[model samples]
Target: MADSEDSTTPPAVSWRAILRGTGALPPAKKTGGAPSDPALQLWRNWQANHTQVVALTRQWQRIETQLIHSVGFPQVTIRLSGEEEPKIAHSVDEIEELLADEPEAERETLIAAFDAQQKRWDEAAATLGFDAVDAELRAALDKESDFTASVPTTKAASLPGIAAKLSIVIQLGEPSPKDTEFPWPELRSALADLARLASPEAAISPL
Candidate 1:
């Protein structure tokens, strides 16, 4: 469809959820009852932007998962002689989950430790070309890259107008050929970045 009128689109979706998922939803509207009252425009804009962010986020998550697993999330230990190395952590998500049930005092400590670990992970990722991959994706999402050139020009026509449902002649269009090459470079670069993250020298130990 040429617009945000998909029948499968969900109701009860939140603007905040879309924002958190992809950081691409339009900014929140504030103030009202003026020549340009934002409250008057919120619902329509919010839903359209929310759906886009959610769909993009799903694609990013799949690429990330595939890259991480492809690299076996390589990680290792770092220790001076006679100093015990900390447990290796591959994913921030896993580390955070482990701290979820802890008392605040202990959780805070754990979180700080994991934050340090994540920094190291990021550094390692940079060494492996992951930085480029990340930058490319962000640029594409921000529409700052040339990726928009790949958007298909002719999408399917909308459902025909009808007085009664059965009166409209709905022609079944053949499925369009999917682009297998689109976004492949971005995804491939991310795998290399993930490979660098698996390195040991840049490993961060939990305190």
Candidate 2:
């Protein structure tokens, strides 16, 4: 059967594009509103910084996703000094857990082996550009924290707290074989808080 014309039709033009083509009149300028109003100025700053943080968050997520897929799971094979058989760890977390279970006197040898193997994974992550994206995300988070500090009564005062947690780089080689989680829950919450606080309806008052 032949497909309907509608099925093959291109998507309709966006309302924004249509309005632009029609040459809509420019918005009216404010007559008496004070441009130097501190509350209004703070809100504007919050809005601009929030938008940039949201964009950087998305970019960070995309790069992190690619890095995770490119370097699957990290596994390490370690041979203790006196052990006849070598130990295998699928992740650095596992190595830590293993070392914790061993006696203090015997842990040094095991730790040395683990460190050697871990260095390989760290180098691998660095070579894959994890360091670059990590730095960018940290900088954005720090900027957001600074903006949050400027507004005393803003509803998103917790933005600084959220940024502190998010800025801590969770090393890539630490995830175990079954660890498939992404750091999105707190990030989404932080973004929501920023958007709400930056909206026109939210009140920003001085202390």
Candidate 3:
């Protein structure tokens, strides 16, 4: 009878009970409320979109200034001489005829002419400092190769008629005067138009 009572007794409580007693359950999380102002939200979005453009413009200006300081006026010159003259053995038709006839002698002459011409061109390129100029140009181009354009990311659906209106504003900014060969004045006018288009209200309520 004593053995049966011991067998009926329950096992010890689990460690999971200790966890529950220690308040191990995750704390309740708080959710944020929706943004209050639609206009402010649009402005914030526009600012974010234009941030990259602003950075790129600054970088471009810096690069331009650096180039101006590094190199003033750039020019390339080439020189040619008779002693190193390029060989000219045959016309295009003559080569074609030689090829058709399978003439070994003519082929050898053509090969020699090609080699001489290549040598002359090489000499000319060296005399003009072509390699150095090319290197400098390449380095300058690399320095100025930050080509980035900023674009707004708000879906078109969010701003139904805004893009078309903005385009019109951009066009109006470039008003041309009669008989002007260049469009500098028109471009200046375009800036004014853009300013008007990008009015505070339009920026806030782009829709």
lDDT over C-alpha atoms for residue 56 of model 2: 69
Rank by lDDT, descending?
2, 1, 3
Local error of candidate 2 at 90, Å? 9.6
What lDDT, from 0 to 1, does candidate 1 have? 0.35
Worst 10 residues of 3 by lDDT: 17-26
Order by TM-score, highest first: 2, 3, 1
Model 1 misplaced regions, further than 4 Å: 1-37, 74-76, 87-207
- Per-residue CA lDDT of model 1 for 122-190, tens digit only, reads 665665556665665575456412222222221212111010011101101112112235443343333
Clashes of 2: 0
Per-candidate total of colliding backbone pairs:
1, 0, 2
- The superposed Cα distance between candidate 1 and the true structure at residue 26, in angstroms, equals 20
Report lDDT (Cα) of residue 189, candidate 2: 40
Candidate 1 displacement at residue 174 in angstroms: 42
**Local accuracy by lDDT, each model:** 0.35, 0.45, 0.34
lDDT tens digits, residues 1-207, model 2?
A: 332322211112211111111211111123365322343344444445555666767876776676557654355566666789987887556667766756765566555656765575567667767677678778877876775566554332233222222222121122432234554444434433432343324332211
Error of 2 at 94 (Å): 6.9
Model 1: worst 10 consecutive residues (lDDT sum): 163-172
